[model samples]
Target: MMSSIKRLLIGRPLQSAELGEQKLNKTKALAILSSDALSSVAYGPEQILLVLITVGAAAFWYSIPIAAGVLILLTALILSYRQIIFAYPHGGGAYVVSKENLGVNSGLIAGGSLLVDYILTVAVSVSAGTDAITSAFPALHPYNVFIAIIFVVFLTILNLRGVTESASVLAYPVYLFVAALFLLIAVGLYKIATGQVPPVLHSPVGTPVAGISLFILLRAFASGSSALTGVEAISNAIPNFKHPAPNNAAKTLIAMGSLLAVLFSGIVYLAYYYSIIPNAEVTVVSQIAESVFGRNFMYFFIQGTTALILILAANTGYSAFPLLAVNLAKDKFIPRMFTIRGDRLGYSNGIIILGIASILLIIAFEGQTEHLIPLYAVGVFIPFTLSQTGMIVKWVREKPAGWIPKLMINATGAIISFIVTIMFFLTKFPQIWPVLIFLPIIIYMFHTIRKHYDAVGEQLRLTTCEPSFQIEGNVIIVPVAGMTHVVENSLKYAKSLSPNQILAVYVAFDREEEKRFKEKWKQWQPDVRLVTLHSHYRSIIQPLTKFVDTVEHKAREANYQVTVVIPQFIPKKGWHNILHNQSSLLIKTFLLYKRNVVITTVPYHLKK
Candidate 1:
């Protein structure tokens, strides 16, 4: 049944022999790993401007310092994760890091944070993109949620189709976004230098730099930190690259860092130069484009590009969430279903789950980027701090003398990330506390589920002791339906249990068949006692319970223990339930409820 669904979703499965290793060259690997980082540039500037708008334009200049801090942190994080990729490149990711160093609960916390962050990445990025498009084409504003859903569905289908397919589709759009944004920056700068002095948008308050506070500056920093959210994707995906994993991962990391830094800095400078501000009314990017290009085709072009980039940011989640789920499945933290590959060899369940979650988020928040921004950065930073700290622990524990300088670098990175995480939690808690409240509930659920699985596993564990059935003269009642293979096999197995006696019992809804079976049993198996119970209501369970009670009473009178054995046929195909039956299970349940009766099942397997 599972195989049928897998085939339906992604066509034929690749045979074990046909499956080849992931052969990612440096360029392709960089594109795949850097997608999340590169996509962040789309919203990083807008987020910074979003916070500044709350306190008026005076706070806008503080974006420069915030951007600078983020850049430094980004560099430190990249360098630190580079060590992670080299040291533990087999792809446990942040969860593995925390587990090996900090412990399982720490890993669970990190995993929870990463899971929430990945979902937000998709929702926030897609919504931001939709806003950009709506800014460019005002008609789209009313249909923003609809547009975001369509984009998410499209991304989900592409991901379900396979990773290479998704990469091929996303690579061009991401590259186009980078190129267009760079061109806009270069031309806008040229306009400024040539005394063209592209008109800055009129500030709602008349002049810039009015009514700002330190609290506001911190708020803007928290919002702007959304750009750094995707930088950890490389660490998660290192194992997917070509051989010599460390070298490939390092190169990918360097490329991602460089691209993010350039794109992020350029966007920040442009947003600041244009005096973009927060409004209960208009979008910052749209107003800025209108000011720079002055109500012309150039204005439309900039708005359109910004919108596309925002929508494409969801592609980052399309790529990362499934990988995170797959990692979790490997650790037994999530359901094993996520560990299974689809026909295309991608984690289809994870992709679909991610898509649905993002869609729900889009609806719940009404596709508003500002609302989702607060809940976004906290999770990513928490995992970032924990993973980096875990890496520091790893470095100290291993203590390779030659790598002391690298260890110090990683230690510094961990400290910086930890501080940032605390700052984000303290300042953004009003907006973020809800997530903190909700995440533990989810973590606890996973923990409970894991405990249940472990308990069941212990119960089912095989032992070397010889099989022993202590019958204490228990009356063994074997339910027989007719001359089926299951019934015959069950009787033979029951005889092996060496019970004191066996009663062949039959409960029949059809009087004619019951009469015929009674006559036949009298002639054929006279040595065996036969008990036939009558059913007035034509209910199988009631009739069976009546017969088992009589048997238990007889066993008590005879000073024998009552034991019931039912023949059950286990189906090979999971979906044969509609055709085959489940009467044996009903009988076993009824028999077990009677006093002094022990019910056992002797399963007979159908031919494959």
Candidate 2:
């Protein structure tokens, strides 16, 4: 019944050979892996202005330079990851690259960092998506966390159905978001160029800021770097692409990066030109849309699509986390459960874990994107730095064709990424320390898991062909309680296991009951010898346990092993369990310490 339910929920079990069927073409791959990067433009520019506005209206203009800096870094990441795709095409993300080129410890740290970042991605995306809705309609703000949790749960179920199905369902929204943003940008640009730009005062109060400082501008750059969080996803999941996987993956990476660059640049320019301020009641994007389209159908259309793409951005994490987990599992750094795919050819365990973690974060933070935004971007850069650094080492050591330029590109990327990581850590120290603390703990866990697997393999390894411990034959013992149908069933099962050797034992607290049971058994001619042990006290378990110990001793002496079969009645309703005496449980508990004695239970279900 459980298997039936699983099959119904996630479809039938897929054969290993069917993996190719799950491979995605370029278009679907972009939708599945690029959603996170593409969706960031919805809020990335606003993150910049939010920090810049802190220094009063005078600092708002600096958003352009900060965005330009971020754009430069983004371009560097794209080029570096393009090299990553070509060199290590077998889905070599940070963990794989670090482990291969750097040391095992570096790989574990990268894995842990990426895992945390994926969790944050889901949390921030869902919260921001929920906030988008509540910003447009304030009446729903109170249930923000609840709405966010619903979105996570829905995505969880959709992803469990399989990767292809999820990509197909979610791909349309990303395109719609892209079209809406492009239209908004074109209109905004045409208006600006034609001297028809609208005024920017949505509220009576002008944009507020504190005094301008270099530290403030750097902080704004670090904040806006949230856009770079999902850039490595394509390089991480190159294996998901169809034929010519590496080439297709690199092309998709370029496509995603190009789209992100254009959309982000256009949005930042419009926001700056319009002098748009981040509104508490609505989003900067929403304000830009309204100014360009004036609360028309297109305004609401852009708003709806923005919310959808933000929510679907989480699908990128779902796609990458499972693959990363499988990589870690294959290396024996984590449990083997993550290596097993579900009926839908998806990593079910990894997907569920991501969902639960993200949901808890949403609950803890009350679905406020600002509170989560500070905690974001820090985990992302940890892997970004490590992956690029590992690639530099790879190029230097392997000396492949054009290794010099490759080394130079990756070296530049690594240094830039490391600087960005430090900037994020220093700027958001209060919110960032938890991730630092979490990294060492995760590394420690990986070492412990490897130790356990090593120890288990040593014990299970076979040196000689001879049996570890020889056993001549089997001795089956059935514990009977009177001549009830359950006892008869257990005796039958014991006979099936050991046809020629079966012993029935009865433990009785009442002499009168024992006498009557023996007489009745003799007349029944059951062809089984019965040994009745008398218990002076009213305890029914002690004598039965001692009998099993004696049987095991006798079997050892005779070069045999003992098997005890006990009968149990399973009640139809769970509440009916309280009505039983639980003698079988007591007998099983005492027999747990018997080394060579095998205990089995035959359950007879009660109809009523």
Candidate number achieving the greatest lDDT relative to the actual structure = 2
**lDDT per residue as tens, model 2, 46-97:** 9888877776555666777788898888888999999878877888488888
Runs of candidate 2 exceeding 4 Å displacement: 1-9, 12-17, 198-210, 464-467, 477-482, 496-559, 568-594, 603-608
lDDT per residue (tens digit) for residues 1-608 in model 1: 77687567565655545334434566766665576677677667777887676776656667778898888888888888888887788765787799889998888888888888878888888888887776666776899899999988877877776766667666666677677667777876787678776545424222456567667666666677778877888777765666777788788888889888988887787677677665534566566567667779877776666666666666666666777788877766788788776767777788889989989989999998877776887788878888888877887788786677777777777776776667677777777787768788878977887887777777677763445444446566787888678877887877777533777888877789899999998786676678887777877788777777776776677676777888888888877766766888777766665666777899999987
How many clashing residue pairs, candidate 2? 5
Tell me the whole-model lDDT of each prediction, alpha carbons only.
Answer: 0.75, 0.85
Reference-based TM-score of each model? 0.78, 0.88
* Candidate 1: Cα lDDT at 152: 89
Largest TM-score belongs to which candidate? 2
TM-score, cand. 2 = 0.88
Candidate 1 is scored at a TM of: 0.78
The alpha-carbon RMSD values of the candidates against the true structure, listed in the order shown, are 5.6, 3.9
